[model samples]
Target: MVVGARLEGIQLSGIRKMFELTTERSVNLGLGEPDFQPAQHIRQALSDAVEKGYNKYGPTSGISNLREALANGARKYRSDITANDIVVTTGSTQALMITAQYLFNPGDDVLLPDPGFVLNVPQVRIAGARPLMYPLKQEHEFIPQVDDLEKLVTPKTVAIYTNSPSNPTGGVMSIEDIRAITQFAEDHDLWIVSDEVYDQIVYDREHQSFLGDYDKVIHINSLSKTYAMTGWRFGFLITKAPIIDKLSILNYYTIACPNVPTQHAALAAMTGPQEHVKQMVNEFKRRRDLIVDRLNRIDGIHCLVPKGAFYAFPKYDFNISALDFAMECARSDLICTHGSAFGDAGEGHIRFSYANSMDNINKGIDIFEEVCEKIKG
Candidate 1:
């Protein structure tokens, strides 16, 4: 009874739970970060910043130069964007954490995607809002539609979270999908919380962001995935609202400020050579192709080729629950996520991250195939 009612139903993330179950022999596909090291120039920049004494507390809204650079990058999406639009945080995770709390009220409803990131549900709940899940059907290529939202929205609905190159499923929303969803939100007068953390890890085609399409968007991004600086934990939030002064004050009370040297390194990351970023994407593409092709060769599995991100989410014609299928894979010394860990829409699927080396990906798939055979019986 001592615990807050809002925290009552919340539990640990199923993704991290699978991760903790990893054994020394486990081929870990359960986690969600790149295996690549921080690029050479990025590392050098952090060293240089520390040597020059950037170790003290810095700006709460992030370093001015980094903010300017991010604003410049985002300006391509919206012409009027400037340094005033950014709020730097510990990570995109925190960006998400704070944004949900800032936007939602005690009784409001926020539409979310089913088979979406696990964090969306808890974040909204803790912020005292109800999460209304809209489905992304495989028949529709795992994209969200206005038709789906029609049933979910009510007068209490306040916002919707949009993820492109979505986690687990690796489904990217199309231009048409983006425009329609934006128009729907406009019609309903709801905030659009857009998470585009995997924006740069895309394959084959350019990924268009959802940020520029609407005025009510609260856009999120970070250096964690793009520069392989996950440990550095740098992220920023963007909005046209003059409310950043208020958000930064909240960020100051909440996170103090992002690490000083990491901010310096982030500056170099945005300004450094384009080669390392390109190389990382190319490597992920190789892994993406490898995992999808091999998983398809497994008789009962069907994986859609992901156009972006480092994940391969495949549906299998198995009688077992996704959690049980994942548990079976764990027994074989391989680790990946159960699809339902995302939501009910994900029940028959499993998610394999291709962020590991090719050797490990192959080894993981080999173990997964054995699990498939066991389930077939």
Candidate 2:
């Protein structure tokens, strides 16, 4: 039997399989998940929920308490959001899926950065929409050029997906850039899906969010990175009432509801001590400094220090493809993701995640340097 085109064409799992095949006893630095455990208070809250019999199905949009907490959290960063505007989902992934499904009709075009998150493009395609690519330039420090975005917009453009402190590249869009994009989206009546998963991981400047300026902005965020609650599968979408209602309906039919325990856990994550988050950010900063310093010293490797996310996307001077370079690194027992896994524009780079321990980061860089030298020689 022939598989569905959407299912057959998706290559994410293939990338995972490649990592599995090539990775040896080497340190695997490709994963972007936080190395820290969920905070003690959050875990205790989950345990307390279980003890209190909160294991039943939650409200489809998430538990009411969690929604309130998520809304409160959003208000700290952006104005004009409330509990009524929030829909808690399994993760930011589900939020993105629901947004795409609700906003885009078949044949509509969804704009995304060229070296953007791989999942966004396929999700748009699976929603029966065309994924229009907008190139983010290395010369521009990987920030999306508003001019390029303007060129990519079409009459059928329904939404533009942006990741600030972006994955792989770690480029954080400035407030000015965000203002221009929001103005453009407002002019064209397009939805802005801002994935702020790394919002808390920013290093240089305070994070700029589209929600502060546009009511139509759909802000997707999670406790996954900030609170080290990845396996808890907790995330929420912040948008206006009408959009929330639509996503809630789609969310109801899809998963019915997020797990009750996870909702309780997420509530704790929102209300719990924020010092853990600060500490993790500090550690990631240290690791970023270490990695950027080492990678830049390598003969043919040039890396830009990441401003936000815990990733360093570095260009390598070798004839081998990014995929092949990643494979070669794996043979040396050091696992890193090829930039091309994100998209075609990512071809000349490799993404090294600093979400690992300092020891692992140090060792991984040493191994990566050795591999690069061997290839260069």
Candidate 3:
């Protein structure tokens, strides 16, 4: 066969599948990217860097100042986080990919959240490993249960992935849940890969991270969601210092090095005016409120209020499967991701990203209601 067997069954992400189907008139909400542009200062910094002839291959571990800035930012989670602990990657996604490739071996099992980020499953498989799952139940507000995790663990299990201010569900882990996960990882002697991309996007309470002084904790984060820097593709990983050196070698071979201009831009984002982030969070909270209220207004839907991130995963009483419902919405010019796209536990639910505007979300919800009415009839 022309294609490699390992990549044979892996399909394009369900979110992207819906996203590619959308037209300008589609009232799209399929993707999770921020609607806002990167902050002005950040943009200017990029332009300045490019104009100043800074476009070159940066250090494989990234520009030292940028790494230092990220390390400083991470200090909030663990006071000891420093430049020595960071390996800047193309994005948080790459950090995750490197982690998977660097650690997982065939026959090893990595426990993932069943309704977790799509990357969590594919990355491990791509590394020639199996992904075991623990359900993130709606009843538990989408938090993983330690008992459930323990049930999935065996001699083969190597690591676990956790996301806070989660993507599809927007479930920010409660402090109790955070403690439970941390303790569980400690007990099992498993590596805790924490994805904190939405760390600064919380609504209700503070985002408590899994990045505390544990050496086994591999913390992955980026400016994509936080500063609307997805296009910049700047992110970093914090782990044991030795592991940072190891991942940096893989990072060098994978991308050679992160682009220089963007590293400067990311540094500006890190050090620039704080008001933009605060303002953005406030706006997201308002959007979240609007989307939840409108989603709950639909006759057969019940939306769980998201305390963080920009997506709403709403459960529906419709007889149709989540994929069919989402496709029906898309056919009707409304873009959404099927709940099952998240995982099996997400069935009967649908993910709507409100990262667009209030006007677009209103239009999408109207299309959703129209679809519901036709199906119910």
* lDDT (Cα atoms) of all candidates against the true structure: 0.90, 0.86, 0.88
TM-score of each: 0.98, 0.96, 0.98
Q: Model 1 over residues 1-377: C-alpha lDDT tens digits?
A: 47698898899988988888899999999889999999888899999999998889988889899999999888777888889899999999899998987888899999999999998999999999999999987778789978889988999999999899899789988778889998999999988999999888788877877777477888888889999899999999999855678778879989888889999899888887879899999999999999999999999899999988889989989789999999989988999999999999999999999999999999999999888988898
Q: TM-score ranking from best to worst?
A: 1, 3, 2
lDDT of 2 by residue, 49-99 (tens): 999998788788887777787887788667667788988888888888888
Candidate 3 deviation (Cα RMSD): 1.3
For model 2, name the residue pairs that clash: 26-333
**Which 10-residue span in candidate 1 carries the lowest summed lDDT?**
205-214
**Candidate 3: global Cα-lDDT?**
0.88
Worst-scoring 10-residue span by lDDT in model 3: 237-246
- What's the best-to-worst order under lDDT? 1, 3, 2
Per-residue error for 81 in candidate 3, Å, reads: 1.0
RMSD of each: 1.1, 1.6, 1.3
